[model samples]
Structures are given as structure tokens and as C-alpha cells.
Target: MRRQKKTILLASPRGFCAGVERAIEIVERALQKFGPPVYVRHEIVHNKFVVNELAKKGAIFVDELDEVPKGATVIFSAHGVSKSIKEQAKIQNMFAIDATCPLVTKVHNEASRHHRKGRHTLLIGHAGHPEVEGTMGQVPEGTMTLIETLSDARNFNPPISDGLAFATQTTLSVDDTSEIISILQHRFPEITGPSGEDICYATTNRQNAVKKLAAKTEYFIIVGADNSSNSKRLVEVALKFGAKNAVLIPDANSLKLNELRNVSVVSISSGASVPDILIDEVLKKLDQEFDISIKIESSIKEDVYFNLPPILRTR
Candidate 1:
């Protein structure tokens, strides 16, 4: 039987942002430099495949510092960690390597600066996310509040609204964040924000590319892990923008090509935490099952690069 023809719109800027890359490498290098049984405070980047690969390389992912033996080397996830975590590591005499993405660190710094100047910070992000928790933990309790929705924005009545500022998770929906920001600004004219966008460049670029293809693609497949915020957001963006059906598959191996038989066009993308090999796998699978025509849908070329931590810089 002749295979059916399908169009594949591949989204660029879709996989392994610099931060994730650096984080994963930090573990690898730490293993090489310090040797494993190296402790990681969290799944390095929320991708099962990545985590498993690292685990195979002797990286031990732990939920907290207590799980680690004192004086052992520990690497923080790219999502960043609370100041308290660092303090705890110090008290434990552990050799800690901070793998927090520099962009996330920027948000932490902004939040801390706001608190220092006595400006209450309205943190725009989902609660319970590691990044949100870490950001919230940046300052003393009550110095910052989590604003997860427009409702949160409208309902927020700070003890004193005049001295206020805002910051956001590095991974978030740009449109959604903007709406929240606009609402907060309307309610509190004095609310300040980051000089640049709080959402990282890779996230914004990936989302923008997906937005362009969503209206045209009938079936959208985002290859990413379940816990990845940016990956899940892509699914939401696709459905919101116009894709008829969208799904988040942890990896290409999890995809169901049978369901795509009736679909003529598919947009394939992955989370920043994912590797492009996963996206390639989806393309390979589709190619084997159908006559697929693939088009690269890219609005921006990402030239940005984040250097690894100072110790890793020499080599």
C-alpha cells in the first residue's frame, strides 16, 4: 500500500535551550572532574531520558540535600535553588555546584533587589513549580507573593501598593504573562518589572514559532517531559492559537502515529529540556510510516550561548 502523504512543520528553537545544555553538562563534567555518586538536588532538567542518561553516568538525583552524604559534591538543577539550600549545603560541608540557569538567577537577583529596596515583588508564575518555589524563597517570607493568574493580579491588594515590583519565571507563556502584567500595572501604576523580558529568549522564540504554525497545522506533537513547563505550554499555545488537536508526548517513542493517519499536517516541537534527537525520532517515525514532507518553521535564529560555570570555563 502506498503510504499517505503528510506535511510536517518542524518548529525551530524547540529543544535544549542553553541553560538546559549547561545544566546537563555540569553534571557530566562534575562526574568527570569529581567522579560520581555525584548528587543532584533535582531531575537535572525534567526530562526522563536526560535524567536516566545522567543516572547511568553515575549522577544521583536527590530530592534534598539531606539525601546526600555530607562533604559530597552536589549540583543544583537549572531551575535554581533557594538561598536556604546553599546555606544548608554550607552547613553540611558539602561541595555544591550551582547549575541554575543564569537567566533564572537574574530573576532571583531582581527579586532580591526589590526586597532590599523595600518593594514587594509580585512573582508571576505557577505555584509549586520548583522555579517558583526557588524564586519565592529568594527573599524573606511576605516580601514576595506568587501571582499565577489574572485573577491573582486583579485581586492583589498589597499592604502598600506604591512600593511594588514584579518578576516572572523564566519559562512561561509570553501572552499570558503580558496580560497579568498589564492587569497589575492598571491596578498599581507604580509596579516595576524587569528591564528585559522575564521569560528567557529561547522560550519566547520557541513559543513564537509555534504560534506561527499552530493556525496552519491540524495536528501538533510536542515532544517533551510531563514536568517541563515550557513543553506543556506549547500544547496549550497550539490549541489556543488554532491547532485542532495537540498532545504532549514525553519522547518520540511515545507518539502514536496511528492517530495521525487522518491528519495531513503536523507541527513537531520539543521542550527546552529535550534533545533534538527526540524531535528527529518523531520525524523518522513519521517518515517510516508515511510519505512526509517536512518544513522548518523558524522565525528567529538563536545565536545566544551561555558559558558554563567559572570552574568549567578553563577547560
Candidate 2:
């Protein structure tokens, strides 16, 4: 029987944003400099593959500061931690290295500035996400309110209307966040916001690439961890942009042949935290099942790069 022909459209700028790259590098460098059993406050990034790889290199993942022995080294996750966590690290006397992405750090700084200026801040993000939790912790408990949906934005009534400001999780859906921001602006005309859009450039570019690919592909697959916000957003963006079917898979191993049996034309992309090696795995798997033709669709060229922490610079 003649094998069926399938076209796989791959989105460019699909995996490992500059921030994720920097975070992983920090962990690897820390392991080399400080020796094994270097404690990490959380998963350096959201991907299981990434965490597992780092673990093999002598990194220890812990949920809280209490887990670390006094005088040991600790590194914070790419999702920035709150003020309290910083204070705790200092008190514990742990040699702490911040692996938080520079972009997320920017949002944290904005939140702190807003609080200092007495602005009743509103954060547009999903509840319980590490990034959201970390950002919220930047200010006093009651100072920042979380606005997760359009309904939340509509019903929100600030105690002091004139002193309102807003900041958002760096990985949120650009389109969805815009709607919430729009609603907030409508309700509170005096509300202040960050000088620029909080969504990172890599996120916006990846989403834009997926949006274009979704229009032409019959089915879409987003390769990323379930907990990763940007990866999940790409799945949503694909479905919203017109793909017939879209799903989030952790890696190439997660794909079911049955799902792609009817999908003649498919598009594949990975979340920001994903490594390109996973994307290659998926492509290899697809090639085995069908006579595949590959096309690379790049929406934009990303030239952004972030440097490692200052402590690692001299190493």
C-alpha cells in the first residue's frame, strides 16, 4: 500500500526563549562552580525534561527554603519569587542565586514601584501559577488584586479609584490580557499601567507564528509541559486562530498515532520553555508514519539574548 502523504508545517521561534536559555545555563554553571547537590527553590523552568536533565547534573529541587541546609547554595526558579522569599533566603544565610528571567523581574519591579507610589495594583494573570504567586508577593497582601478573566475585570471596584495601576504575568495570552486590560481601562480611566506591554517579546512572536500556521494546518500540536503557561497559550491561540484541532503534548512520546490518522496537514510548535530537541523528536516520529513534506514558516527572527547572573560571570 502506498503511504499517505502529509505536510508538516513547523513554526519558527518555537522553543527555548532567551530567558529559558539563560535560566538553564545558570543552573548548569552553578552545578559546575559549587559542586553537586546545589539546591534549587523550584523547577528551574516549567518543563519536566529540563528539570530531569538538571537533576542528573547534581541539582536538587526543593519547594521551600526550609529544605536547604544552612550555608548551602540555592537558586531561585525562572519565575521570580516574592519579597518574603528573598528575605527568608537572606535570613537563612544561603548563597542564593536568582535564576528568575529578566523579563519577569521587570514585572516584579513595576509592581514594587506601584505599591511604593500607593497605587491599588491589579495583576492580570491566572491564579495559583508560580509566576502569578511570585508577582503578587512583590507587594503587601491587600495591595494587589488578581484579575483573571473579563468578568473579574468587569466586577472589580477598587477602594481608591484614582490610585489604580496594573501589571501582568509575563507569559499570559497577549490577546486575552488585552481584553482584560481594555475592561480595566474602561472601568478605571485613571488606572496606570507599565510603560510597555508586559508580555515578553518571545511570547508575542511565538503566538504570532502559531496564529499564522493554524490558519493553514488541519491539526496543531504544541509541544510543552502542561504547567507551562506559554505552551498552553499556544494551544489556545491555535484553536482560536482557526485550526480544526489543537492539543498540548509534553513531548514527542505523548503523541498518539490515532489522533493524526485523519490529519493530512499538521502544524507543530513548542512552548517557550521547550527545547528544540523535542521538536526534532516529533518530526522524526511523524516521518516514520507518513511520507512527510516539511515547511518552515517563520513569522519573525528573534535575536534577543540575556546574560547569566553576575556571580557566574567571573567563572
Candidate 3:
């Protein structure tokens, strides 16, 4: 039998964006500084591998402040949290550490500013997402209205003020967000928004890189956990950009050998929180199934870094 060869194209600037790195570090450092049983209100990031590792190291995940005992330390997820959550933590006397990504924090700040100015806050994000919940939680109840689609933007009506401002989840489809934003602007000409939109640099850059690769690749794979928003977006972008098929694989074990039966070129990118090791394992899996050649599809180089909180910051 003549051996068939396959080619793998790895996307640069994929995985471990600054925000995810910071959130994970916060959890680890909390474990180091405060000892075991440190409570994190949600998955520090949406990657199961990362969460499982932290769990092994003494981090406890809970859905609410009530689960954490009074005076115990609790860290917020990178998605940010609502104001009511803060008040609840204060009332319980639990020590609070915020692990919200600074980019997400920018949206929170924008929402707060809009609230203070009496403008009804319109949040552009999916419902029930931790980031949306956290951002909306930053203000009084009913202050920020969630708009997930262009229809939602068109139909939204707020009481007390037509004065409107908007923010968005950091991980979202750039093309889709633009449509939603346009609908809001068209419906309410005076609505204000943050400069350059609320989607973070990492999300935008990764999606852009995938789009660049999808045009020429026969198949595309995104390395990310199922619950990860940015990882899901990468798959969507690949399909939209002309790849024959785009699939998300959590790790090497999840990759299906049979699917690559005759695939010629594959483009691979990882979610911002995913580790490179996961990608390497997937490559090995591919190699085991067929004679494989590797190529690096280079794009933007990212070096952004975020500082830890005062508690973890070195003097």
C-alpha cells in the first residue's frame, strides 16, 4: 500500500491570551498565599483541563457566594461579576479576589459610567454567560438590558431613559457583533459605545488569524473546551470563511481518526485559554494515523501581559 501524506498548518498567536494567563495565576497564587480550599465562584477560565488542575491543587469551585463559608476567600471568574455579588460577599465577610479580565473590566467600567450618567445600559452578549452576568451585575438590577441578536437590539425598550449606551462580551463573532451594533445605532441614533467596540484584542486577533488560514485549508480544528466562548467562535469563523468543515477538539483524545480519511490540509488553532500541549497531542494523534508534514502559518505576534492583583503582586 502506497502511504498517503497529510499536512498540518498551525496558527500562531493561538491560545493562552493574557487574560486567561492572569486568571489562572490568580487561582494558583491564591492557593500558594492563602493555602488550600480557596473558593472560585466559577471556572477561572472555561477550559476543563485548567479547572481540573486547579481543583487538584486545592481550589474549590462554587456557583454562589452562599457556598463559601463566611471569612473564607473567594475569587471571581474572569468573566467578571455583578454588583449584587460584591454586596453579598461583603455581607458574608468573605475575602474577595476579582479575577475578571481587564478587557472585560473595561466593559464593566463603561456600563457603570453609562449607569451613572442615567443612560440605560445595553449589553451585547449571550444570556446566562458568566461574562454577561458579571457585567450586568455591576449595576442595580434592570439597569443593563441584554441584547444577544440584531432582533433583540431592534426590539429593546428601556424605562426612564432613552439615553442608551452599549458594551459587549469579549469573546464574540466580530462580523455578527458589527451587525448588532449597527442595528442599535440605527434604532437609537444617540446610543453611545466604547471606543473600537468591547470585544477584546485576543478574541479579534485569533478570529482574524483563523479567517486567514480557513481560506486555503481543507479542514480546520479549534483547540478549546466545549464551554469556551472564544473556542466556539473560532469554529464558526472557520466555517464562515470557506473551510470545508471546522471542528473543535478539547484535546488529542477527542480528535477522530476516521474524519481525516482523505483530508489534505488542516489548519489548527487553539482557544485563548487552551494550552499548547493540547495542540501538540492532537498533532501526534494525526501523525500516528498518517504520514504527516507540518507547517506554521504565521500571523500577528502577541506579547500582551496583565499584572496580578496587589495581593499577588511582587514588590
Candidate of highest lDDT: 2
- Candidate 2 residue lDDT tens string, 1-315: 777889999999799999999999999999999898999998899999999999999999999999999989999999989989989999999899999999999999999999899998999999999999999999999999999999999999897757999999888899999998988888887889975559999899999999998888898999999999999999999999999999999988989878888779999999999988899999999989888999999889989999898899876
Query: How well is each residue in 1-315 modelled by candidate 3, as lDDT tens digits?
Result: 655688888888799999999999999999998999999998899988899999999999998888999999999999889888988999999999999999999888888899899988888888878898888888888778889988898888767556888888999999999999988888888888976578898999999999989988888989998888999999999999999989998998988878888888989999999988888889888887788899988789888999999988852
Evaluate residue 150 in candidate 2 and report its C-alpha lDDT on the 0 to 100 scale: 96
Q: Candidate 3 — number of clashing residue pairs?
A: 3
* lDDT at 182, model 1: 89
Off by over 4 Å in 3: 158-161
In order, the Cα lDDT scores of the candidates are 0.90, 0.92, 0.89
Model 1 scores worst on lDDT over the 10 consecutive residues at 188-197
Off by over 4 Å in 2: none
* lDDT pick, better of 2 and 3: 2
Best-fitting candidate, scored by TM-score: 2
Q: Which of the two, 1 or 3, has more lDDT?
A: 1
Minimal lDDT window, size 10, model 3: 153-162
Per-residue alpha-carbon lDDT of candidate 1 for residues 1-315, written as tens digits (9 for 90 to 100): 999999999988689888998999899999998887899999989899899999999999999899999899999999999999999999999999999999999999999899989998989999889999999999998889899998999998897747999999999999999999989888887788986459999889989989999999899999988889999999999999999999999876788888898999999988899987787788888899999998988888888778898887653
Q: What's each prediction's TM-score?
A: 0.98, 0.98, 0.96
**Candidate 2, after superposition: displacement of residue 101 in Å?**
0.6
